[model samples]
Target chain A: MTFVNVGTLGTQPGQREAVVAILTRANPQLAQAGCLLYEVGTSEESPDTVFVTELWTSAEAHQESLQLPSVREAIAEAMPLLNGQMSGFQYQISGSPLRD
Target chain B: MTFVNVGTLGTQPGQREAVVAILTRANPQLAQAGCLLYEVGTSEESPDTVFVTELWTSAEAHQESLQLPSVREAIAEAMPLLNGQMSGFQYQISGSPLRD
Candidate 1:
């Protein structure tokens, strides 16, 4: 059972664009690190919010990916644009919300 | 920002004590759907691999506490002990890998 790392980001009210830029630029690095899917999206109702969803092969694989210099650098770059504490979880997918 | 729903649960090796007793009895319906911190943890070198962490606030008040009904009958009785395909996201926290 692989792990999916899900995260939600809250930016500085109007700093959504900067956040998106950071995330978009960082996606390739994640992909190269065996990320099954990586996306950073904005909410229609909440303009200041950003959502990050990722699927990785395993916890160890995800950790190995994070150890890459590019991942570290990208995260460092994103750190400033963020506002509050980063909270997240790496889950094993208990149920599929998909209907297809 | 108020959104933190990170989950990682993989069972069936040893059932992880009945999935931690259905996540400790569903953690008070996710602490009245206003959960600040809910934890069901155990990973000393990965024992059947179960780790679920939550801290919810926004997201329409966690979807209005999942529309009650006893949290959908404790998630339909743990969806028959779960297996796979449940990916999760929903984050507002950006970076707080607490070190204190």
Candidate 2:
């Protein structure tokens, strides 16, 4: 099954866009490493929150991508903007638009 | 910008698959209503939680979809199976794999 990750990162007020920019710039590198979908956005209901949704070929692929230098650097850059409140859940995708 | 919804629905033990099935069956109709991406998944870390990730052409498109008879029926059908614990956030997608 494909691996799915959906998470929310809470940032300091007005820092949401910065965190999103860092993640968005890292997408090309992420896609090169088996990321099927890498989407980043800011919450409409919460001005200080950013949402990250990802789909990978497999859990192993996602784990391996984390080891890539680009991803590690992006994480390091985003850490400071984060407000220390984040939550996420991992899922096994059974169906998706890509399948059709 | 597209509208993105990332949410988790908690179901009764062993009812996750049933909820997924219903949502999966509803996808074609959703797509016809401007749903760019509609995926349903089961959490790897939580057996009774289901994740729904969606992308729509716009927030208005999503709102209109909810008024569709088919969508309303699906929601009505899924409500009974829900454990009444659900949380979600809406976002404005600025970047996605589909863009590239």
DockQ of each: 0.07, 0.51
RMSD of 1: 10.4
Model 1 lDDT, residue A69, Cα = 83
> Which candidate has the highest lDDT of all?
2
Two-chain complex of model 1, DockQ on C-alpha atoms against the true structure: 0.07
What is the clash tally of candidate 1? 12
Clashes (candidate 2):
0
TM-score of every candidate's chain A:
0.80, 0.89
TM-score of chain B of each: 0.30, 0.89
Per-candidate total of colliding backbone pairs: 12, 0
Across residues A28-97, which tens digit of lDDT does each residue of candidate 2 receive?
Answer: 7677777988788876678898888888888889999989888898889999999999998788877863
- Candidate 2: regions farther than 4 A off: A96-100, B96-100
> Ten consecutive residues with minimal summed lDDT in candidate 2 chain A?
A91-100
lDDT of 2 at A85: 98
Which predicted model would earn the best DockQ? 2
The docking quality of candidate 2, as DockQ, is 0.51
- The lDDT of each candidate is 0.62, 0.82
